[model samples]
Structure formats: C-alpha cells, structure tokens
Target: MTQTLTLTWTTVCLLDRLEPDRGVAALVDGVQIALFRTADGLFAIDNRDPVSGAYVLSRGIVGSRDGVPTLASPLHKQVYDLRSGHCLDLPGVAVARHEARCRNGLVEVRLRQEG
Candidate 1:
C-alpha cells in the first residue's frame, strides 16, 4: 500500500516583492528559511549556515556555478547548491532545502521533512 503525504505550505510574501538575484529570510514553524529569487526560479533553503552556525544564508551572494544555481556563504564563502542544499566547496555538508512556489502572486514555502 502507498501512503499519501500532505504538506502544509506557509505564505511568505508577494512574488513581486522579491527582487531578482536576491534572498530574504522568513520564519516558518519557528524555523528560519532563506528564500531566493533567481533567474532560474524561486528556491528555499535553511537560513543557518551549517559551517558557520550563523543565520546568514539569506544574505549570501547569489550566483551560478557550472550552470547550477548557488548561494555563497557570507562568512566563510562556502558555496551551496540552492536546489539541493549541497555544499559545493565542502563535501559531505549540506543544508535543508524546502519546497517553494508562487500561488496567486504570493510566495509559499513548505518545510522539508528531515529524519
């Protein structure tokens, strides 16, 4: 038997409020999530930097590496793939990625379940 999973999405902000190639921080369910608006699309990831232990990913530089959207940590400059939350500069390190979308001009985010 297969079970269906339902996700609760939180409305963060208006899509137009987010500038392209920038990021913003939002607290969803007491968890800090960083939302980014890039040329590729909207992405959501943990605001905390695993290596630096700082909630600064939202302020990280938005760029691309090898055609993959990336966010570079402002503290240590660790590059992370925005889609998968995988650290590019440091292997075996990653942040939590959340599902984000735009509905009726509002940006919504669904926290990713972690085991």
Candidate 2:
C-alpha cells in the first residue's frame, strides 16, 4: 500500500538568494532538501545526490533531455528525474520527491509527514 504524508511548506529563504548553476539546502521537519532555480527564472530542483549520498546535486549542471528537465550530479555524472526523483541513467536509484508550489512570491515545498 502507498502511504501519503502531508508536508508543510515553509519559506526558508527568498528567491533571490538562489543563484544560477547552484542550489540551496533546506531542512523541513528533519528532511534535508535542496532547492535550485534555473537561470531563466524558471524551474527548481532538489539538491540531494542519491548516488554519492551528498547534498551536491544543487551544484550540478542543469540541462534538458528532449525538453525534460534534469539535474546532473557534481561528484558523478548521474542524472536524476526532477519531478519524480528517479534516476534515468541508473536503475533503482530514486530521490525523495516533494510537492513544490509557488504562492504569493514564495516558493513552498510540501513535505510528507508520518502520522
């Protein structure tokens, strides 16, 4: 069975705090998350590098595979699925995906919590 967790979205920082080609790490209820805003003022990806177990995915290169947004790892070239948190290049590698929404000029990441 699938369990659904409700994660509260909190504004950890401002949008201007994020720079191009880099990401910011934030903690929501003990969960480590990375947020990245693309250079074009669109798109954000969590910075967790599942392959290397490092929070360096934010520092990875941002590119698209046939228009699909993807984040490359800084340590390794492993790419992950930003929306579903799946590893395209590697099988069985998945990252924690959060429900993110932008509202009132603030970006909020919905975290999942256990009841």
Candidate 3:
C-alpha cells in the first residue's frame, strides 16, 4: 500500500525579501529550506547538500541548465534543478523539493510531516 503524505504550510518571510536570481536559507519548523527567486518563478528545496552534507545550498548560484532553472552548489559545484531537485553532475543524487508560494505577500512553504 502506498502511504499518503501530509504537509503543513508555514510562513517563512515576506516575498519581497527574496531577490531575483538568488537563494536564501530559512529554518522552517526546524527544517532547513532553501528558497530561490528566478526569472521563471520561486522555488524551494532542501538546504542540505547531498555531496557535502552541509546546509549551504542557500548560498548556491542560481542559473539555468538547458533552459531549466538550476542551482549550483557553492561548496562542491553540483548542479541541481531548482524545480525538480535533480543533481545534474552526478546520477542517483537528488534532494527534496518543497511546495512554496506567495500568499498575500508572505512566503509560505508546505513541509511534509516527518515520520
């Protein structure tokens, strides 16, 4: 049987705090989430680096990979799709992607309930 996932949305900050083409790390309900603003839209992902295992993805560079918005790790240079959290440099490596949106100018993130 497949288990259903439950999410709890929490406000991170004001949407105006996010700068275009940049990433910001926010501790949301004890989880480190990396928020990004690009020309396409806003995205959120796990702040931990799969390779380095550090909370540094928030400082990663925002760019594009084949027209897809991508975030490159500043610590190890691993490219990850901001929307899908796919690691481009290495296979079988990926991070968690979260649902984020602007609700009344406030940044809200849907965090999955931990087991």
Q: Pick the candidate with the highest lDDT.
A: 1
RMSD score of candidate 2 (Å): 2.6
lDDT of 1 by residue, 1-115 (tens): 5543436999999999999998899999889999999998999999999998999999999999999999999999999999899999899999989999999999999987654
What TM-score fits each model?
A: 0.93, 0.80, 0.92
Off by over 4 Å in 3: 1-4, 113-115
Task: Report the backbone clash tally of model 1.
Answer: 0
Ten-residue region with minimum lDDT total, candidate 2 = 38-47
* Candidate 1: residue pairs that collide: none
Better of 1 and 3 by TM-score: 1
Given candidate 1, what's the lDDT at residue 82?
94
lDDT of 2: 0.68
By TM-score rank, best first, the candidates go: 1, 3, 2
Tens-place lDDT digits, model 2, residues 1-113 = 67777755677666666675566677766677767666434343455677777777757777767666777788978887676778889999877767665666677777754
Q: Model 3, 1-115: lDDT tens per residue?
A: 5554757888998989999998999998788999987888889999999999999999999999889899999998999988888899999999888888888999899875435
Better of 1 and 2 by TM-score: 1
The candidate that wins on TM-score is: 1
**lDDT, each prediction:** 0.93, 0.68, 0.89
